[model samples]
Target: MLLESLSPLSGMINLVLVLLSVLTSAFTAAVGVGGGVLMIMALAQVMPAAALIPVHGMVQLGSNVGRTAMTWRHVNRAMLAAFLPGVVLGALAAAWLLVRLPAGVLELSIAAFVLFTCWGPGLPKRALGRGGILIVGAVTTLLSSLVGASGPVVAAFIKQSQEGRLAKVATFSACMLLQHLSKAFVFGVAGFVFRDWLPLMLVMVAAGFVGTWLGLRLLHWLPEHRFDNLFKWALTLLALRLVWLGGQRLAGAG
Candidate 1:
């Protein structure tokens, strides 16, 4: 039964991923972002392309749920309310279009935006308001549907907000929970078989919760100034990685 549930992955590989989920979840919980991007990148190495996004979404949904539950008090309720509509809009748009963009172009676009958001001038207050968050919801969800990890983009946008570290992490996790939830629905409607992957996903999510608990403790210990620097550098590195990937893809295509 265990082997059957894991399907294509061998027992050893399944074990490895479960362990990785804990580490990656902790990293994201402590750092306030980048964990999902790291998780998806690792998944891509071992998972079939067709199963990658949906599986990643399912796992991430669980991880974010853990984080959100632990930090629910810190979430920005008003922002979350605004972002929900966008999630619906974006999911509907993705389901309606059902087209994949050229991966290279999408990667490059996302990378550039992440870099600019990290280093560029801060967005005006107006652009970070309810209207802006709604737009962010739609665009990030659509991009996430295509690319599998829009966490960086969403984190970048949330980084612009004036919320404290805990609030930012909490709210980001809440937003991601919604995005991943929408993703599951979209993929289910498209006829992906999630049941075959359920056992592994369940174990991974449980591991991620353990990691989230540890990470939140670390988050409490870290100095605020250090966290700000770490968060920016972490985003910068992830964006650079995206740039490298995009370049490789375009070059290969050329």
Candidate 2:
């Protein structure tokens, strides 16, 4: 009965996505970022483009919520407070526009920014504070609404901070939670019927929680230096892939 309800997906596909949710959630929880990007890339292969962003946003919303709950004690309250207003503004702006940008252009722009954040000169201390966070919040949230996964961009911005590993993971989860929440609202208003996907999303979210728990355990065992290197290289590789994909898309369009 339940299997019958998850239309447009065979039972095997549903099982695959559920397992993917677990793996990706664990990846993000331990490594601090890139999981959502990976998950969306996988989903894009199977899901219709029209349903892709909203469905992925819903699943990520659950994954982030689970991570945030588990690591709530380590979250940076000050940064989150400063980021809220920007989230509101960004969501509102996205709602007003309601137009999808060219895929290649958005992909290239995001990849460039992620690479720059990973390797470019660090921002001054002041720029890493409230004002900078506010801008990051607005811009990344806006981008997420269109792109389906802005976790790497958000993680890259947070990477500039001097917080310890746990705090960084916690804060990134919190920020992504808010971003995905805004995405839910925007897509809801845009007339995306989320009910159709609710059952699968719920199962995926449950699997994600289990993955988050295991990943947090791994996070504790990893050394700070190793974590830093892993995080950086993971993001760099993902960004480079985006660059390649974006170039291919542009060539095809041309």
Pick the lDDT winner. 1
Cα lDDT tens digits, model 2, 149-169, are 578888888898746889989
Residue range 1-254, candidate 1, lDDT tens digits: 56445757888789889999999999999998888988998899988998999999999999999999999999999999999999999999987786666658888888888898889998889989999999999999987886785898889889998468898799999999999999888898888999878888999999999999999999999998888888888899998998999899988888
* Residue pairs whose backbone atoms clash in candidate 1: none
Full-model lDDT for every candidate: 0.90, 0.88
State the number of backbone clashes in model 1: 0
Prediction-by-prediction clash tally: 0, 0
What's the lDDT for candidate 1?
0.90
Least accurate 10 contiguous residues by lDDT in model 1: 1-10
Over 4 Å off in model 2, which ranges? Answer: 99-103
TM for every model, in the order presented, reads: 0.96, 0.95
Worst 10 residues of 2 by lDDT: 1-10
RMSD of 1: 1.3
Residue 59 of model 2, lDDT score: 91
